[model samples]
Target: GAGVSQSPSNKVTEKGKDVELRCDPISGHTALYWYRQRLGQGLEFLIYFQGNSAPDKSGLPSDRFSAERTGESVSTLTIQRTQQEDSAVYLCASSFRGREQYFGPGTRLTVT
Candidate 1:
Protein backbone atom coordinates (compact mmCIF):
# COMPACT_ATOMS: atom_id res chain seq x y z
CA GLY A 1 0.00 0.00 0.00
CA ALA A 2 2.96 2.30 0.53
CA GLY A 3 5.34 3.73 -2.03
CA VAL A 4 8.72 2.34 -3.02
CA SER A 5 11.42 2.15 -0.37
CA GLN A 6 15.20 1.63 -0.50
CA SER A 7 17.52 0.72 2.33
CA PRO A 8 20.82 2.37 3.21
CA SER A 9 19.97 5.75 1.70
CA ASN A 10 23.65 6.49 1.54
CA LYS A 11 26.65 4.16 1.33
CA VAL A 12 30.37 4.68 1.11
CA THR A 13 32.57 1.68 0.31
CA GLU A 14 36.17 1.19 -0.67
CA LYS A 15 37.08 0.10 -4.14
CA GLY A 16 36.84 -3.64 -4.84
CA LYS A 17 34.40 -4.18 -2.01
CA ASP A 18 30.98 -5.63 -2.56
CA VAL A 19 27.72 -3.90 -1.72
CA GLU A 20 24.11 -4.97 -1.61
CA LEU A 21 21.29 -2.45 -2.19
CA ARG A 22 17.69 -3.24 -1.45
CA CYS A 23 14.37 -2.00 -2.81
CA ASP A 24 10.77 -2.68 -1.84
CA PRO A 25 8.22 -1.82 -4.48
CA ILE A 26 4.68 -0.75 -3.94
CA SER A 27 2.21 -3.55 -3.32
CA GLY A 28 0.44 -4.96 -6.39
CA HIS A 29 2.72 -3.22 -8.88
CA THR A 30 3.58 -5.65 -11.66
CA ALA A 31 6.51 -3.81 -13.21
CA LEU A 32 9.62 -3.00 -11.25
CA TYR A 33 12.70 -1.18 -12.54
CA TRP A 34 16.14 -0.11 -11.41
CA TYR A 35 18.12 2.90 -12.56
CA ARG A 36 21.41 4.63 -11.87
CA GLN A 37 22.10 8.35 -12.00
CA ARG A 38 25.53 9.81 -11.95
CA LEU A 39 26.16 13.40 -10.97
CA GLY A 40 24.79 15.81 -13.60
CA GLN A 41 23.64 12.88 -15.71
CA GLY A 42 20.27 11.48 -16.59
CA LEU A 43 18.89 8.28 -15.16
CA GLU A 44 20.18 5.11 -16.80
CA PHE A 45 18.00 2.07 -16.90
CA LEU A 46 19.62 -0.91 -15.21
CA ILE A 47 17.03 -3.67 -15.12
CA TYR A 48 13.36 -4.54 -15.27
CA PHE A 49 11.32 -7.24 -13.56
CA GLN A 50 7.78 -8.23 -14.31
CA GLY A 51 5.91 -10.84 -12.41
CA ASN A 52 7.76 -14.15 -11.73
CA SER A 53 9.33 -14.44 -15.16
CA ALA A 54 12.93 -13.84 -16.16
CA PRO A 55 14.18 -10.31 -15.47
CA ASP A 56 15.21 -7.97 -18.28
CA LYS A 57 18.77 -7.21 -17.27
CA SER A 58 20.06 -5.78 -20.51
CA GLY A 59 20.97 -2.46 -18.96
CA LEU A 60 23.44 -3.81 -16.45
CA PRO A 61 26.84 -2.19 -17.01
CA SER A 62 28.91 -5.30 -16.34
CA ASP A 63 28.98 -8.84 -15.00
CA ARG A 64 29.54 -7.52 -11.48
CA PHE A 65 26.05 -6.07 -11.40
CA SER A 66 23.00 -8.20 -10.74
CA ALA A 67 19.52 -7.98 -9.29
CA GLU A 68 16.62 -10.19 -8.27
CA ARG A 69 12.95 -9.67 -7.38
CA THR A 70 10.75 -12.20 -5.65
CA GLY A 71 7.15 -12.03 -6.79
CA GLU A 72 6.13 -8.33 -6.65
CA SER A 73 7.97 -7.58 -3.44
CA VAL A 74 11.49 -6.74 -2.38
CA SER A 75 14.43 -6.64 -4.78
CA THR A 76 18.15 -6.42 -4.29
CA LEU A 77 20.89 -4.96 -6.46
CA THR A 78 24.33 -6.30 -5.74
CA ILE A 79 27.55 -4.73 -6.92
CA GLN A 80 30.79 -6.67 -6.76
CA ARG A 81 34.30 -5.26 -6.94
CA THR A 82 33.12 -1.71 -6.55
CA GLN A 83 34.92 1.00 -8.49
CA GLN A 84 34.87 4.77 -8.35
CA GLU A 85 33.10 4.90 -11.66
CA ASP A 86 30.26 2.94 -10.10
CA SER A 87 29.53 5.74 -7.69
CA ALA A 88 26.07 7.06 -8.34
CA VAL A 89 22.54 7.21 -7.04
CA TYR A 90 20.72 3.92 -7.41
CA LEU A 91 16.99 4.37 -7.93
CA CYS A 92 14.11 1.91 -7.91
CA ALA A 93 10.65 2.34 -9.32
CA SER A 94 7.47 0.32 -9.76
CA SER A 95 4.14 0.70 -11.51
CA PHE A 96 1.18 -1.12 -12.87
CA ARG A 97 0.26 -1.24 -16.55
CA GLY A 98 -0.21 2.20 -18.15
CA ARG A 99 0.64 4.11 -15.00
CA GLU A 100 3.62 6.27 -14.13
CA GLN A 101 6.16 4.66 -11.85
CA TYR A 102 6.67 5.55 -8.20
CA PHE A 103 10.36 6.00 -7.40
CA GLY A 104 12.22 5.41 -4.19
CA PRO A 105 14.40 8.08 -2.58
CA GLY A 106 17.48 6.34 -4.02
CA THR A 107 20.69 5.04 -2.48
CA ARG A 108 23.60 7.40 -2.94
CA LEU A 109 26.62 5.16 -3.40
CA THR A 110 30.14 6.48 -3.12
CA VAL A 111 32.99 4.15 -3.97
CA THR A 112 36.32 5.36 -2.76
Candidate 2:
Protein backbone atom coordinates (compact mmCIF):
# COMPACT_ATOMS: atom_id res chain seq x y z
CA GLY A 1 0.00 0.00 0.00
CA ALA A 2 1.02 3.61 -0.53
CA GLY A 3 2.17 6.00 2.16
CA VAL A 4 0.16 8.95 3.37
CA SER A 5 -0.77 11.56 0.77
CA GLN A 6 -2.21 15.03 1.20
CA SER A 7 -4.10 16.98 -1.44
CA PRO A 8 -3.62 20.58 -2.57
CA SER A 9 0.09 20.78 -1.77
CA ASN A 10 -0.38 24.53 -1.57
CA LYS A 11 -3.37 26.65 -0.74
CA VAL A 12 -3.85 30.41 -0.47
CA THR A 13 -7.13 31.84 0.74
CA GLU A 14 -8.65 34.95 2.22
CA LYS A 15 -8.75 35.30 6.00
CA GLY A 16 -12.46 34.62 6.20
CA LYS A 17 -12.60 31.82 3.70
CA ASP A 18 -13.01 28.18 4.54
CA VAL A 19 -10.61 25.45 3.47
CA GLU A 20 -10.73 21.70 3.33
CA LEU A 21 -7.58 19.59 3.37
CA ARG A 22 -7.62 15.92 2.53
CA CYS A 23 -5.30 13.10 3.52
CA ASP A 24 -5.13 9.50 2.38
CA PRO A 25 -3.33 7.19 4.74
CA ILE A 26 -1.79 3.87 4.03
CA SER A 27 -4.05 0.86 3.97
CA GLY A 28 -4.23 -1.31 7.12
CA HIS A 29 -2.83 1.41 9.36
CA THR A 30 -5.04 1.81 12.39
CA ALA A 31 -3.76 5.05 13.80
CA LEU A 32 -4.03 8.41 12.04
CA TYR A 33 -2.82 11.77 13.24
CA TRP A 34 -3.16 15.38 12.16
CA TYR A 35 -0.61 17.98 13.05
CA ARG A 36 -0.02 21.65 12.30
CA GLN A 37 3.31 23.41 11.92
CA ARG A 38 3.67 27.14 11.79
CA LEU A 39 6.62 28.64 9.98
CA GLY A 40 9.86 27.55 11.67
CA GLN A 41 8.00 25.83 14.50
CA GLY A 42 7.64 22.23 15.53
CA LEU A 43 4.67 20.07 14.59
CA GLU A 44 1.71 20.58 16.90
CA PHE A 45 -0.54 17.59 17.38
CA LEU A 46 -4.10 18.44 16.46
CA ILE A 47 -6.02 15.21 16.52
CA TYR A 48 -5.74 11.45 16.60
CA PHE A 49 -8.01 8.80 15.12
CA GLN A 50 -8.17 5.07 15.61
CA GLY A 51 -10.17 3.32 12.99
CA ASN A 52 -13.13 5.62 12.22
CA SER A 53 -13.35 7.30 15.60
CA ALA A 54 -11.31 10.08 17.14
CA PRO A 55 -10.55 9.55 20.81
CA ASP A 56 -8.29 12.53 21.42
CA LYS A 57 -9.18 15.88 19.89
CA SER A 58 -8.04 18.16 22.67
CA GLY A 59 -5.14 19.38 20.61
CA LEU A 60 -7.39 21.17 18.18
CA PRO A 61 -6.63 24.87 18.62
CA SER A 62 -10.11 26.20 18.22
CA ASP A 63 -13.69 25.49 17.28
CA ARG A 64 -12.86 26.50 13.74
CA PHE A 65 -10.65 23.44 13.38
CA SER A 66 -12.01 19.95 12.93
CA ALA A 67 -10.93 16.62 11.44
CA GLU A 68 -12.32 13.19 10.73
CA ARG A 69 -11.03 9.89 9.40
CA THR A 70 -13.00 7.08 7.84
CA GLY A 71 -11.67 3.72 9.05
CA GLU A 72 -8.05 3.53 7.88
CA SER A 73 -8.64 5.42 4.67
CA VAL A 74 -9.03 9.10 3.83
CA SER A 75 -9.23 11.92 6.33
CA THR A 76 -10.34 15.50 6.02
CA LEU A 77 -9.39 18.60 7.96
CA THR A 78 -11.62 21.62 7.78
CA ILE A 79 -10.88 25.17 8.80
CA GLN A 80 -13.72 27.64 8.98
CA ARG A 81 -13.40 31.42 8.88
CA THR A 82 -9.69 31.11 8.53
CA GLN A 83 -7.39 33.65 10.10
CA GLN A 84 -3.85 34.81 9.43
CA GLU A 85 -2.66 32.94 12.48
CA ASP A 86 -3.99 29.74 10.99
CA SER A 87 -1.44 29.74 8.20
CA ALA A 88 0.77 26.68 8.47
CA VAL A 89 1.62 23.30 7.05
CA TYR A 90 -0.85 20.59 7.96
CA LEU A 91 0.65 17.14 8.17
CA CYS A 92 -0.91 13.70 8.36
CA ALA A 93 0.66 10.54 9.68
CA SER A 94 -0.41 6.94 9.89
CA SER A 95 0.99 3.98 11.76
CA PHE A 96 0.23 0.38 12.45
CA ARG A 97 0.09 -0.78 16.01
CA GLY A 98 3.53 -0.47 17.66
CA ARG A 99 5.18 0.63 14.42
CA GLU A 100 6.82 3.89 13.43
CA GLN A 101 4.68 6.57 11.89
CA TYR A 102 4.75 7.48 8.21
CA PHE A 103 4.13 11.15 7.50
CA GLY A 104 2.59 12.81 4.49
CA PRO A 105 4.18 15.58 2.45
CA GLY A 106 1.89 18.10 4.12
CA THR A 107 -0.48 20.79 2.90
CA ARG A 108 0.84 24.33 3.04
CA LEU A 109 -1.93 26.78 3.80
CA THR A 110 -1.56 30.53 3.64
CA VAL A 111 -4.28 32.83 4.86
CA THR A 112 -4.14 36.38 3.71
Candidate 3:
Protein backbone atom coordinates (compact mmCIF):
# COMPACT_ATOMS: atom_id res chain seq x y z
CA GLY A 1 0.00 0.00 0.00
CA ALA A 2 1.13 3.52 -0.72
CA GLY A 3 1.92 5.79 2.19
CA VAL A 4 1.39 9.47 2.67
CA SER A 5 4.09 11.75 1.28
CA GLN A 6 5.13 15.35 1.72
CA SER A 7 7.26 17.64 -0.38
CA PRO A 8 10.25 19.82 0.53
CA SER A 9 11.15 17.64 3.50
CA ASN A 10 12.76 20.82 4.78
CA LYS A 11 12.00 24.46 4.17
CA VAL A 12 13.74 27.68 5.22
CA THR A 13 11.93 30.97 5.09
CA GLU A 14 12.33 34.49 6.38
CA LYS A 15 10.07 36.08 8.89
CA GLY A 16 6.91 37.73 7.52
CA LYS A 17 6.99 35.58 4.41
CA ASP A 18 4.59 32.81 3.48
CA VAL A 19 5.04 29.16 2.74
CA GLU A 20 2.97 26.40 1.26
CA LEU A 21 3.44 22.85 2.45
CA ARG A 22 2.14 19.99 0.34
CA CYS A 23 0.85 16.54 1.18
CA ASP A 24 -0.22 13.63 -0.96
CA PRO A 25 -2.16 11.08 0.99
CA ILE A 26 -2.61 7.43 0.24
CA SER A 27 -4.97 6.83 -2.60
CA GLY A 28 -8.56 6.07 -1.60
CA HIS A 29 -8.18 7.69 1.78
CA THR A 30 -11.11 9.94 2.59
CA ALA A 31 -9.96 11.66 5.73
CA LEU A 32 -7.02 14.03 5.85
CA TYR A 33 -5.47 15.95 8.71
CA TRP A 34 -2.86 18.64 9.26
CA TYR A 35 -0.84 18.97 12.43
CA ARG A 36 2.05 21.00 13.69
CA GLN A 37 4.72 19.74 16.03
CA ARG A 38 6.95 22.20 17.80
CA LEU A 39 10.45 21.33 18.88
CA GLY A 40 10.34 18.61 21.51
CA GLN A 41 6.58 18.96 21.83
CA GLY A 42 3.53 16.96 20.94
CA LEU A 43 1.60 17.26 17.74
CA GLU A 44 -1.06 19.92 17.59
CA PHE A 45 -3.99 19.35 15.27
CA LEU A 46 -4.55 22.09 12.75
CA ILE A 47 -7.29 20.99 10.44
CA TYR A 48 -9.19 18.00 9.09
CA PHE A 49 -11.10 17.29 5.91
CA GLN A 50 -13.43 14.47 5.03
CA GLY A 51 -14.98 13.57 1.72
CA ASN A 52 -17.47 16.28 0.80
CA SER A 53 -17.72 17.41 4.39
CA ALA A 54 -16.90 20.72 5.98
CA PRO A 55 -13.36 20.88 7.25
CA ASP A 56 -12.73 20.84 10.98
CA LYS A 57 -10.36 23.70 11.75
CA SER A 58 -10.96 24.14 15.43
CA GLY A 59 -7.33 23.51 16.25
CA LEU A 60 -5.81 26.03 13.89
CA PRO A 61 -3.53 28.30 15.86
CA SER A 62 -4.56 31.54 14.24
CA ASP A 63 -5.90 33.24 11.16
CA ARG A 64 -2.56 32.94 9.39
CA PHE A 65 -2.88 29.22 8.94
CA SER A 66 -5.21 27.43 6.56
CA ALA A 67 -5.48 24.14 4.71
CA GLU A 68 -7.34 22.69 1.77
CA ARG A 69 -8.00 19.23 0.43
CA THR A 70 -9.06 18.55 -3.10
CA GLY A 71 -11.48 15.62 -3.11
CA GLU A 72 -9.29 13.39 -0.92
CA SER A 73 -6.24 13.52 -3.09
CA VAL A 74 -3.69 16.25 -2.48
CA SER A 75 -3.80 18.64 0.42
CA THR A 76 -1.90 21.82 1.10
CA LEU A 77 -1.24 23.83 4.23
CA THR A 78 -0.57 27.50 3.83
CA ILE A 79 0.94 29.75 6.42
CA GLN A 80 0.83 33.49 5.92
CA ARG A 81 3.31 35.85 7.55
CA THR A 82 5.52 33.12 8.83
CA GLN A 83 6.99 33.79 12.22
CA GLN A 84 9.50 32.21 14.54
CA GLU A 85 6.62 30.92 16.59
CA ASP A 86 5.23 29.27 13.48
CA SER A 87 8.38 27.27 12.93
CA ALA A 88 7.65 23.59 13.32
CA VAL A 89 7.22 20.32 11.51
CA TYR A 90 4.01 20.25 9.57
CA LEU A 91 2.67 16.72 9.38
CA CYS A 92 -0.09 15.27 7.26
CA ALA A 93 -2.12 12.16 7.85
CA SER A 94 -4.74 10.21 5.97
CA SER A 95 -7.09 7.41 6.90
CA PHE A 96 -10.17 5.59 5.73
CA ARG A 97 -12.29 6.86 8.58
CA GLY A 98 -10.94 8.99 11.40
CA ARG A 99 -8.74 6.38 13.03
CA GLU A 100 -5.56 4.56 12.05
CA GLN A 101 -4.08 7.51 10.29
CA TYR A 102 -1.03 7.08 8.07
CA PHE A 103 1.48 9.88 8.52
CA GLY A 104 3.78 11.56 6.06
CA PRO A 105 7.44 12.36 6.43
CA GLY A 106 6.51 15.86 7.51
CA THR A 107 7.72 19.23 6.23
CA ARG A 108 10.02 21.04 8.60
CA LEU A 109 9.49 24.76 8.45
CA THR A 110 12.15 27.10 9.74
CA VAL A 111 11.48 30.79 9.99
CA THR A 112 14.35 33.16 10.49
Candidate 4:
Protein backbone atom coordinates (compact mmCIF):
# COMPACT_ATOMS: atom_id res chain seq x y z
CA GLY A 1 0.00 0.00 0.00
CA ALA A 2 1.22 3.45 -0.83
CA GLY A 3 1.52 5.84 2.07
CA VAL A 4 0.78 9.52 1.95
CA SER A 5 3.30 11.62 0.00
CA GLN A 6 3.87 15.33 -0.63
CA SER A 7 5.89 16.90 -3.41
CA PRO A 8 8.88 19.26 -3.44
CA SER A 9 9.57 18.86 0.28
CA ASN A 10 10.38 22.54 0.07
CA LYS A 11 9.27 25.52 -1.95
CA VAL A 12 10.51 29.07 -2.18
CA THR A 13 8.14 31.59 -3.63
CA GLU A 14 7.91 35.33 -3.82
CA LYS A 15 5.16 37.11 -2.00
CA GLY A 16 1.91 37.61 -3.90
CA LYS A 17 2.50 34.61 -6.14
CA ASP A 18 0.49 31.41 -6.40
CA VAL A 19 1.70 27.94 -5.50
CA GLU A 20 0.30 24.46 -5.59
CA LEU A 21 1.27 21.54 -3.40
CA ARG A 22 0.39 17.94 -4.07
CA CYS A 23 -0.47 15.03 -1.83
CA ASP A 24 -0.99 11.34 -2.55
CA PRO A 25 -2.76 9.39 0.11
CA ILE A 26 -2.85 5.73 0.79
CA SER A 27 -5.28 3.48 -0.95
CA GLY A 28 -8.63 2.66 0.66
CA HIS A 29 -8.48 5.61 3.03
CA THR A 30 -11.63 7.67 3.10
CA ALA A 31 -10.50 10.70 5.02
CA LEU A 32 -7.85 13.27 4.19
CA TYR A 33 -6.69 16.29 6.15
CA TRP A 34 -4.42 19.28 5.56
CA TYR A 35 -2.53 21.07 8.30
CA ARG A 36 0.00 23.83 8.66
CA GLN A 37 2.87 24.17 11.11
CA ARG A 38 4.78 27.41 11.11
CA LEU A 39 8.30 26.66 12.34
CA GLY A 40 7.99 25.82 16.05
CA GLN A 41 4.22 26.29 16.19
CA GLY A 42 1.71 23.52 16.64
CA LEU A 43 -0.21 21.92 13.85
CA GLU A 44 -3.25 23.87 12.70
CA PHE A 45 -5.92 21.99 10.86
CA LEU A 46 -6.63 23.60 7.52
CA ILE A 47 -9.20 21.38 5.91
CA TYR A 48 -10.56 17.85 5.81
CA PHE A 49 -12.41 15.74 3.33
CA GLN A 50 -14.29 12.52 3.98
CA GLY A 51 -15.75 10.39 1.26
CA ASN A 52 -18.31 12.26 -0.81
CA SER A 53 -19.54 14.73 1.73
CA ALA A 54 -18.69 18.42 1.74
CA PRO A 55 -15.13 19.34 2.65
CA ASP A 56 -14.44 21.00 5.97
CA LYS A 57 -12.73 24.26 5.17
CA SER A 58 -13.22 25.95 8.50
CA GLY A 59 -9.52 25.98 9.32
CA LEU A 60 -8.24 27.55 6.14
CA PRO A 61 -6.23 30.63 6.98
CA SER A 62 -7.79 32.89 4.38
CA ASP A 63 -9.46 33.05 0.98
CA ARG A 64 -6.09 32.44 -0.62
CA PHE A 65 -5.89 28.89 0.65
CA SER A 66 -7.99 26.10 -0.77
CA ALA A 67 -7.85 22.32 -1.22
CA GLU A 68 -9.67 19.57 -3.02
CA ARG A 69 -9.80 15.79 -2.81
CA THR A 70 -10.78 13.57 -5.68
CA GLY A 71 -12.94 10.63 -4.57
CA GLU A 72 -11.10 9.90 -1.33
CA SER A 73 -7.77 9.73 -3.08
CA VAL A 74 -5.23 12.31 -4.16
CA SER A 75 -5.49 15.89 -2.95
CA THR A 76 -3.91 19.25 -3.73
CA LEU A 77 -3.55 22.50 -1.83
CA THR A 78 -3.43 25.75 -3.68
CA ILE A 79 -2.42 29.08 -2.23
CA GLN A 80 -3.32 32.05 -4.32
CA ARG A 81 -1.60 35.37 -3.84
CA THR A 82 0.74 33.83 -1.37
CA GLN A 83 1.92 36.09 1.37
CA GLN A 84 4.92 36.13 3.66
CA GLU A 85 2.76 34.93 6.52
CA ASP A 86 1.87 31.88 4.50
CA SER A 87 5.38 30.52 4.81
CA ALA A 88 5.07 27.27 6.73
CA VAL A 89 5.18 23.53 6.49
CA TYR A 90 2.04 22.23 4.82
CA LEU A 91 1.30 18.67 5.85
CA CYS A 92 -1.09 16.10 4.52
CA ALA A 93 -2.52 13.12 6.33
CA SER A 94 -4.92 10.34 5.51
CA SER A 95 -6.80 7.70 7.43
CA PHE A 96 -9.95 5.71 7.50
CA ARG A 97 -12.67 7.85 9.01
CA GLY A 98 -10.20 10.33 10.48
CA ARG A 99 -8.73 7.82 12.87
CA GLU A 100 -4.97 7.57 13.29
CA GLN A 101 -3.91 9.58 10.31
CA TYR A 102 -0.61 8.88 8.52
CA PHE A 103 1.45 11.94 7.67
CA GLY A 104 3.44 12.92 4.66
CA PRO A 105 6.88 14.50 4.61
CA GLY A 106 5.23 17.91 4.03
CA THR A 107 6.05 20.82 1.80
CA ARG A 108 7.95 23.66 3.40
CA LEU A 109 6.90 26.93 1.80
CA THR A 110 9.16 29.93 2.16
CA VAL A 111 7.83 33.27 1.05
CA THR A 112 10.33 36.01 0.29
Best by lDDT: 1
lDDT, model 3, position 38:
99
Give per-residue CA lDDT, model 1, range 1-112, as digits (tens).
6789999999999999999999999988999999999999999999999887799999999999999898889999999999999999999999996389999999999999
Candidate 2: residue 75 lDDT (0-100): 91
Say which prediction, candidate 2 or candidate 3, comes out ahead on lDDT. 3
Report the C-alpha lDDT of model 4 over 1-112, residue by residue, as the tens digit.
6789999799999999999999999898899999999988999999999999999999998999999888978899999999999999999999987689999999999999
Q: Model 1: runs farther than 4 Å from truth?
A: none
The lDDT of each candidate is: 0.95, 0.92, 0.94, 0.94
What's model 2's overall lDDT?
A: 0.92
- What pairs collide in candidate 1? none
- Over 4 Å off, model 3: none
Show the lowest summed lDDT stretch of 10 residues, model 2: 47-56
Q: What's the distance in Å from true for residue 7, model 2? A: 0.5
TM-score of each: 0.96, 0.95, 0.97, 0.96
Task: Report the lDDT of model 1 for residue 94.
Answer: 95
lDDT of 2 by residue, 1-112 (tens): 6789999999999999999999998888899889999999999999988875545899999999998777678999999999999999999998997389899999999999
Instruction: Select the stronger candidate by TM-score from 1 and 2.
Output: 1
